[model samples]
Target: PGLEVSMTMLAVDALLDEVAENRAHIGLAYNPPPHARIAYRASSAQPVVLLLRKDHPLAKRGGPASLNDLQAYPLALMPSTFGIGHVVSMAQVAANVSIRPTLVTNSLSALKRFVTAENFMTLVGEFAAYRELGSEELTTVAVAHPLFESAQARVLVKADRPLAAGPLELLKWIEERMPMFAPVKRPARRKPIR
Candidate 1:
């Protein structure tokens, strides 16, 4: 496809509205609303993790932590306006505790800076933070709470409109690249003697 890619970040409602109105061809949202006018190309449920600096108090524990443990530290949570926050909020409610953030913003860079500068923690999808976690700049503790283990990321397109070359290509790319959240399978050993 020769078409150029133009990307814009829109709030979930606004993005859905645009897709419904045909103003945009496709939308990638964290938690797509259930609507008849949109088609789901691909979607996956990802585990939510608590991210913090390696030297943070929680990192030394070497085990998964519950939402109750997170309450002990200052947080730099995304506000409830974003879809990820909705998952976090549900976990907070189910755990019967509050996560009082030292800072609240939707920007990933801001969250990184906050956790780096101070002993702040944040919640993120394991896939979204994979690279950083691998780099050792941050370490994750599993949320291990039922309410949060089901958050999903979605790829949506207009139901009525046939996808053009560019949009179709993008849709296929996304569907193929959706990360496999399960362990990789290894080949079985062959018998050495007959």
Candidate 2:
């Protein structure tokens, strides 16, 4: 939460690049797990992934969110500064459709604030919006296909050494509270790109 984090939100591939070079105490924070392993040792974080917002047409699409259905709308997205671009890549593969976001911003808090009456859709970390999702302000959208398997969010210690004192303490805290963590999830199918 402080400067020690260096950078909190980064594109996963770039993060991997850093870890490969022994640059950062890098770990991937993902709602869905990646199939291939990277150059770092891995530990996991529980996830509370949320499919949020209602009346946003996506739910009203009635049947499942088919590729054709997804094509009809411009999505509201977190800016490329955040992982929304990565999320879109994941979604593009899963939904078998390309998405052009109507808007993008990096702020999770801002995204939450903006979704009030907009039909925008976003997949977020479970902890990120637990209160609202629990209160039924949002609902988890079920996808017909699956992408990620068991592993969820990943925590990587820098290559040469291990996570030290304070950071180690934080990791332990996360592990103890793991139940609140949501396992990485995916739609049943990784739709082929068109």
The lowest-lDDT stretch of 10 consecutive residues in candidate 2 is: 142-151
**RMSD of candidates 1 onward, in order:** 3.2, 10.7
Question: Residue-wise lDDT of candidate 1 within 1-194, one digit each (tens)?
Answer: 47788899876777888898999988888765577898877777877788899998888877888777877889887777667677777767776778777788878778877877789888887777777888877888887787567777788888868988888887777677556422346799888996
TM-score of candidate 2 versus the correct structure, residues matched by position: 0.61
Q: Per-candidate TM vs. native?
A: 0.83, 0.61
Q: Which stretches of candidate 2 lie over 4 Å from their true place?
A: 1-28, 31-52, 60-64, 79-84, 90-96, 148-151, 178-194
Residues 1-194 of candidate 2 have per-residue lDDT tens digits of 45255565566556665655667654555532342434333455433232547666676555445445444665556554344455556657766677676667766766676665666665455556767677767764543434312224665555456666666666565555554433455669977899
Error of 1 at 64 (Å): 2.0
The residue pairs found clashing in candidate 1 are: none
Which candidate number would show the highest TM-score if scored against the true structure?
A: 1
